[model samples]
Target: MKEYVLLLFLALCSAKPFSRPSYMTLKNMMLEDMEDSDDDDDDDDDDNTLFPTRTPANPFFPFDMLPTCPFGCQCYSRVVHCSDLGLTSVPSNIPLDTRMVDLQNNKIKEIKENDFKGLTSLYGLILNNNKLTKIHPKAFLTTKKLRRLYLSHNQLSEIPLNLPKSLAELRIHDNKVKKIHKNTFKGMDALHVLEMSANPLDNNGIETGAFEGMTVFHIRIAEAKLTSIPKELPSTLLELHLDYNKISNVEQEDFKRYKDLQRLGLGNNRITDIENGSLSSLPRIREIHLENNKLKKIPSGLQELKYLQIIFLHSNSITKVGVNDFCPAVPKMKKSLYSAISLFNNPVKYWEVQPATFRCILSRMSVQLGNFRK
Candidate 1:
């Protein structure tokens, strides 16, 4: 038995030892096994499987497939923020699917024709606080879907031609724009809000029928050189702000065409007198801002407005507040009570004014008075 055991041990030692398969051979075997398993599982319900139908080519997943963001800019989803980078021009690599591009506070001087090309999905473009002096006529031809455009605080001398007809809101305030051509806003039927304040615009600078094609509701031409309200303005205006202008008086016909105007702002102007029936046409007016002007007395037609709620007449030369200045004797005729009446810094004597003068106001605190300093 010992001799037999010794011989078996020697035979085992001399024979080739059992070894593990090589890595490639084991990998091939595993692949074959997976293929056989997949073939067998193909008959089973795919929804009940433990693994996916196919593996994704990218290991980092969905983010790796997104369009590349521009350098020195931040992009997320469909909005690209490229503000305050001192960029000389619009970045060329803006994604095709971008919805909004904020390029404000840059040094960009001009917008070439192809600057915003191929961005059909774009909705808003903010070029505020830039040095933009010129925009190519066809610069916005491709961005037909753009709605809100902010070009404020720039050096633009005129409204850019070929603006997107789908535009709804346009802010070109604090620019060098002096003139508005007749066809500047042509075909822009969707435009509603236009802010062109702090420009050098005068009445003559606006050509006839300049605003004929648009149905804009809110227009702000404040801090400009306008001496009188432009008659060429659209009659569809709901809010008209000409504050900080050189307007001397409110004529009877100044607001006749603006019968739909709800809010009127003529504050910080040179207005000394308002005609007797100047505000009678604005039956729907809710607020009137006439502060910081040279008016001698309250305008005549306030009591007739049934919906007038707020009136700002502070910092004027008015010395009296009549009991009927703001409200009619029959209070039931007025649809809305005065919410605010500002008369401070005028020469009016507070004690002399009767308490009944503010009977139509909602609250006594809403009536501001008695802070006159010569």
Candidate 2:
């Protein structure tokens, strides 16, 4: 009876791959290479389709001490997530049906083409915090179904030519990258979030159409050594993070096409002068962070920003005063627009127009506001 069941199991395995290496088999196989890697296959190993009974040589030990697979590995199931492992080499013989592979915090030196070949069902591939020097052409060529690819905190000097077309989120933060290839993310039609923060993308942060296919919510280039905003971005980005960059100047034309941008973080830089019409066209802007830099004068037409909610202008050398500077207005603006304004630490000590800033700050407050004399 047992032999019949074993035969049926073996037949099933040959017809389709096993869901995964059974726990007992993984414990035994991962410890040592299978003895059946030889010429003639052993029928006994096949008979015990799930696991062969191992005599208790030593008491059961935790499964953590197994031989470490090299980097660029493919763990087949949710059971094999790679997090914070200090591995240095790409492992061989990865499980083919891996759904989510966390290659985060490993010392993977290279990413060759088709490195993830067998992992056809890969969903999330995290390559964060690795010593990755280069990603070979077609490294993720066939990984068509990938949702998120996190390659942050690595030493990637160059940009990937063609990221996966099916990718939704890509986070490549804090690296030694300078420029993004014009065709960097060329054919990627469905890309949404691109977080390239804290890299030394030196003057040419991202080339025109660098984000060719993204029609998503945000595009953050914060903390990257850039002096100004990249003019050529997707027409639909809602939140733009150009904060902590080396931006010293911004005119109205620079932000003309960004009509859809809502949250703009241009704080922590050297933007002292705001042209009269600099933020005139951005009506949809809600939260604007222009704090911690230099600003002597802000525009009056900025009051046209009807959706302006939060304005953060702290630690700036702003010495000018105007109601529109803090609370940019919109057409037929409701009393419920501007919510919070934090200019708590500005250079001007006495404020004749302090109450208006308070009004803009409390714009979003649903409760009745306390009136402070200007």
Candidate 3:
């Protein structure tokens, strides 16, 4: 029986086995896989669509979410806005890279040193409408990039000391500033716009040469108690607003230094007389606002204003308007109604300048000529 079984297996091995399908053969599958691998080798690494290397997921770290802003302040990107927050003091936890900080309309009573010590990147600071009574000398010394500072509507009695020299605009309007001591803004040569209006600045508070070398473009000391024009105003000033003061007269030397003055606002004052040739010093002067004053006659030397465009002498006690006062500008005035020589509401003779409306007290009455006829 064993021999018979061995003979049968030998016979089956020797005989041609039933032909297996090519798909069911292991060698055929291995050959197909090799062909696919050879085809993949032709592709470049960039064209390969392999999964990207994954970074280990890090859990949240508190330092990554930095607490750079104060508790109640709203910080967006790099600006911190704490206005109208009733904050009595500056939050010391401000970010070092903060660019603009608006702390206006708050109850901040004082600004001490180190309140903004390390903030070197700060540019604009708005502290307007605060109850700031005092500011330490070095309060803003470290902020070297500070440019625009608004301290309007504060209770400050004097100009804050040690202000950043890089400031381009400084406004302290509507404050209780009693005096402007000598060298108050000594090194602020870069200052451009300065507005100290509506302050109770003393008559002699502005020291001589207080604004000696500054290239200030705009200066406003209006609504103060100045009896006379402050001596030695910066000659670089373009627009000077000194209206609403106690100035009784204007001397020739009062404006001798400002040759480039454009707009002069001396209205709402007690100006009774302006020295002869006072307007001549300002050769480039365009507009002179002497309205609501006590002038008896127009200031002499208006003919020298080659660039004079407007002279607002309305609501004054002027009794006369000299022909020479505006004759030099009449030629240009005829071409354009914008060059107004408004002498409205003055007690001057209406018929002197024929065809001009002078009896109209309800409106600003102006002298009429060919161009001014109404």
Candidate 4:
């Protein structure tokens, strides 16, 4: 009888059929389970970010990050300016439509062919003031529209080949170039200005007609190692600066091709003599600088420069000059083209010193009429 009563009491306290838990209690339990799952997912995301399964490191920047230009550079209007940034190579992220690129004052040592491959709109490229030593032969062949290229003040050893024909101005001064090949400027028909001063150019390294068929106006090969004037210079040249070379004399036909030359600078050389009629071809010559040379006497042919304006014979060993040699027709030339002559620091003695105000034209009338030093 006792066992039956205990069983009835247990059945009354136990859960009956079709009975369900409270709705609030079930909702709370689901919320707790979701919170635990979210925590586990957060830890997984952190691990993947640290060691991404897709890549070793993230290649793309965060979407919220801002685009940054090169250090110490300015980018605007599709032009990238990274001058004086101490760059060792050309920046690879330049804008596509960049019209100008100024990479001057950097430490770039070499330029590969693909450096500027896709810069089709680039019109000007300034690479001056860098440590550039070698440029791939086809480095600039792709810059078809490039007009001006400044490669001065560098350590280049040779003139780069395959230059674009559209280049109008190329400045490569103050370099270590030792020679100029025959085809250096072969197809450069539109090249009008070339600055190649301060190079150690070899005497026989220049091939014949290296600068043929160009409209180059000014040529600066000063301080080069030329023992004599290079032949076949362009007739369109207006000014020629060949100062500080090893030339010992000026031949008559040296300048026979330059009829339009206006100024000639041959200073600081070993020029001991200038042959007669050496300067007769340059009738339009205005200024001639022959200072600091081994000249013992003024070249009598210089008197034939009808349009001569000034002649610098300072710091030379000249001993004497004849007034008749330079001014046989002084009365007639005084009205037109008498030039200023500087003879300072020389032992030169003029037998007939005219008035300081007299302007005279040197004449080639007679070589025997004057007692000029031989």
Q: Pick the candidate with the highest TM-score.
A: 1
lDDT of 4 by residue, 1-374 (tens): 89999999999879577856555555555556547655765877654432334431223333323344556789875578999888999987776567899999999999998888887888999999999999998888678988999999999998888988888899999999888877688878888888888888857877787887788888888878988888887888889988988989899889998999988999999999999888878888888889889999777766566677677887788876665555445554432354466766776555444443233634322112223333
lDDT of 2 by residue, 1-374 (tens): 99999999998888955585456865776445335432213544454433435443434444564334435443432324657667665545455656677767778988887678866677888888898989887777778788888889999887676677888898999988888877687776678888989888856656777667657677888897788767778878888898888888887787788888888999898887777787867878878888877876554565667767677766666555665555545435534455666554566543355555545444345212222223
Candidate of highest lDDT: 1
Off by over 4 Å in 3: 1-67, 329-338, 355-374
Model 4: runs farther than 4 Å from truth?
Answer: 1-71, 77-79, 328-339, 350-352, 361-374
Q: For residue 188, what is the lDDT in candidate 2?
A: 69
What lDDT score belongs to each candidate, Candidate 1 first?
0.91, 0.70, 0.80, 0.77
Determine which window of 10 residues in candidate 2 has minimal summed lDDT. 365-374
Candidate 1 structure quality by residue, lDDT tens digits, 172-217: 9999998999888999999999999999999999999899878999
> How many clashing residue pairs appear in each of the predictions shown?
0, 13, 2, 1
Runs in model 2 deviating more than 4 A are 1-79, 327-332, 354-357, 360-374
Local lDDT at 227 for model 1: 96
Cα lDDT for residue 210, model 4? 81
